[model samples]
Target: MAIARTWKSHSVLPGFGLALGFTILYLSLIVLIPLSATFIKSAELSLGEFWAVVTAPRALASYRLSFGAAAIGALLNAGFGLLTAWILVRYTFPGKRLVDAFVDLPFALPTAVAGIALTAVYAPNGWLGQWLEPLGIKVAFTPLGVVVALTFIGLPFVVRTVQPVLEDLEAEIEEAAACLGANRWQTFARVLLPALWPALITGFALAFARAVGEYGSVVFIAGNMPMISEISPLLIITKLEQHEYAGATAIAVVMLVASFALLLVINSLQWWVSHRHGRKQ
Candidate 1:
C-alpha cells in the first residue's frame, strides 16, 4: 500500500525528477563546470600572484574603465531608452517603421563591422570626426570611444526590454490622472514612472551585463591603450595570448564574481520595487 501511494504521488509530480535532473545537468555543464574550472586554474596562483595578476596598474585601470563606461552607458541608455520607447509607443510619424527596425541594428550587425564603421566615423580624419577634431574632442582610440561602443551595444538591450512593457501600459490611468487635474509632468512622475521602474531596472541591468563583457567592438576604437582606454575583457585576452592561463582565469573569475554581485544588487532592488508596488496595489 505504501509503495503504491508513493508511486501515485510520484505520478502527481511526474516530471519533478526529470526537471531537477535536467536543470542540475544543464547548469553544471554550462555554468558551474566552466566557472569551477576557472577557479581551479586560478587557485593554482598564490594569493600574491592572483593579486598581481588582477591589480597590475594597467589591469586595474582597464577594470575601472570597463566597469565605469558600462555603468555610464547603462545610465545613458536607461534615460534615452525610456524616451525612445515612449516615442515609439505614443507617436506615429513618417518612417516610424524604419526607425523601429533600425533600433535592432546593433543586434544584427557584426561587432567587427560595427567597430570598423565606428572607428572610421569617429577618427579625426573621418567625416564627423574631422569637424570635431578642431574642437579637440578626440573620440576614436580614447575612453570616449569605449563609452561610445558600450553605449551602442547596450542601447538595444534597454530599448527592446522596455518597449513591450511600455506598450502594455494602460493610457487610461494617465488620462484619469490628467482628467483629475494632474499636469503632464505630475502624471508621469507620480503615476507612470513607478510602473515603468521595474522594466527600466531590468533593462539597465541587462545592458550593463552585456557591456561589461563586450570585446570586439571596443578593441579597435579603444586603441588597446593600457591604463587608458583598454577594457577588462581585452586584458583577459591579452593574458591568454601570453599563455598566462592562470592569470587569465584569475581575471575571468574576478569578472564573474563582480558581475554576479552586480546582478544580485540589481535583483534586490527589483524585489524592493516590486514589493512596494504590490503594497501600493
Candidate 2:
C-alpha cells in the first residue's frame, strides 16, 4: 500500500504556512517597507541631482573616512579578537570571568555615554591624550578618533563571534599537528586557521557593518568637521537638519546599497570557504 506524505516529516514545526506568512509580513513591516520608502523619496531628485548629491566632494570625503576607518577597525578587531578568543578558550587564569564579562561592556553601555567617555579619556587635557599630545599624536576630534571609537564598539562583535567556535574546537587537533612535526606557526596556519577562517570572516563582516552605520560614538570624536572627519551617517543627519530630505535619502540609499554589496561579498567569500573545506573533508 502507498503511504501519504506528511508535513510533520518535512518540518519539525507545525503550521509552516502560517509561520512563513508571518515571517514575510513581519519583514515587510519592519524592513522592506522602510527601505522601499527611502528609495521612493530619493527618486524625487533627478538622476543628475542624485548623482551630484552622492558624489559631491564632501560626500566622497565622508564615504572614504567612514568606509576606510570601519575597514581598518574591523581588520584590527579580527586579529586581536582571534587572539583574545584563543586565550580565553585555551588558558585558565584568575579574572578570566571578569575579562569575559568586560567584553560585553560596549553592548550594554549607551552609545552616547561611550562616546563621551572615550572623548574624555582621549581629549587634549584628558588622561591618555595629555601624554600623547606632546608627542604629536592626537586622538580626540580627529579621523583617528573616529577609528578609535569604531574599534572600541566593534571589538565585541569579533570576540563574541569567534568565542563559541573556539570553545567547540578540540585541542587534540593542534597536538596531532605538532606530533606530525608541525611548528607553532605551521600548526596554526595548516590546522587551526582553516577551522577558524569562516568565523573570522563572519566577525569581520559584523564589525565592519556595525562600524559603518555607527553614529553616536563617532559623532563626538569625529569633530563633525565637513569633509574631514564627518561620516556618512552624520552627513545624512546634517542633510536632514537642513530639510534636504531628498539629499538625505540619497546619501542613505548609497550607504544602504554599499553596505549590502560589501556584506554580500563577505558572505559569498564565507560560503566559498565552507564549500571548499567540505570538499576536502
Candidate 3:
C-alpha cells in the first residue's frame, strides 16, 4: 500500500514571520512604549491626586470644551466633507483639481501658520470678522474659534477618506436605483449612503481624534483662557510648564482613555453596520 502524500499550504508573500516580527517591534517602539510611559508616570500620583488633577474645575472645563468642540467639528466635517467629496467625484467644473488640492492644505501647512492665518482672517478687525462683527457673530478668541480651527484642520481627513470610496462607487448603481422607481433622495438614502457609511464613520473618528489633540492651531486662536477656550492639550502643556509632570500625565491618561472609549464605540457601530449590510445582501 502506498502512503498518501501530504502538502503544506503557504502564503505567497515570503517572510511572513519576519514581517510580523518587524510590525510588532515597530508598533512597540513607536506607539506602545510612549503610551505605557504616560501611564507609568501617572502612577506616581496617588489616586486622590490623580482624581483631584483630572476633576478640578478648570480641568473639567477644559475636558468639556475639548470634547464638545471636537464633536461639533467632526459633525460639521462629516456633512460638508461628504458634500465636497460628492461634488468632486460626480461633477466637472473649473478649478476642480485646484479645489481638490486645496482641501489638503491643512495637512501640509504648519499648524502655527494655519492658526496665524485663521486669526488674521477672523479677528474682529480682520476683513471677514469686520463684516460679521457688526452682526454680533464673533468667531476668533472664543470657544467658537476653537471649533472653527478644528473644523478647518479636520475637513481634510473626512474628504480624503470618503473621496476614494465615492470614486470607486460606480454611477450605474444610482441609475439602477432610479430605474427601480426610486427618487434621488431614496437612491441616496438607501443605495449610496449604505456603501459610504463605513468610510464616513472612519473619517469622522479620525477628524475627532485629530481635533482632540490639536494644540498649536487652537492655541493661537483660542486665547487660552483657562476655563473658557483652553483645551485639554493646552492644560497638559500648562502642567508641564509648571513642572507638574505627574499631573500632566494624569490629564493625558484621562484624555487617552476617553478618546479610546469613544473610538471603540464608533468602531463597534461601524462593524455592526457592515455586518447588517452584508446579511441583507
What would the per-residue lDDT of candidate 2 be over residues 25-92, giving only the tens digit for each residue? 99999999999999999999999999999999999999999999999999999999999888889999
TM-score to true structure, per model: 0.92, 0.93, 0.93
Kindly report which residue stretches of model 3 are placed more than 4 angstroms away from their true locations once superposed.
1-16, 278-280
- What CA RMSD would candidate 2 show? 4.1
Per candidate, the number of residue pairs that clash is 0, 0, 0
Return the lDDT, model 3, position 1: 33
Candidate 3 lDDT, tens digit per residue, 104-219?
A: 99999999999999999999999788998999988999999999999999999999999999999999999999999999999999999998998899999999999999998999
Q: Whole-model lDDT, candidate 1?
A: 0.90
Cα lDDT of candidate 2 equals 0.93
Error of 2 at 202 (Å): 0.6
Worst ten in a row by lDDT for model 3: 1-10
Cα RMSD, each candidate:
5.1, 4.1, 5.0
Better of 1 and 3 by lDDT: 3
Off by over 4 Å in 1: 1-17
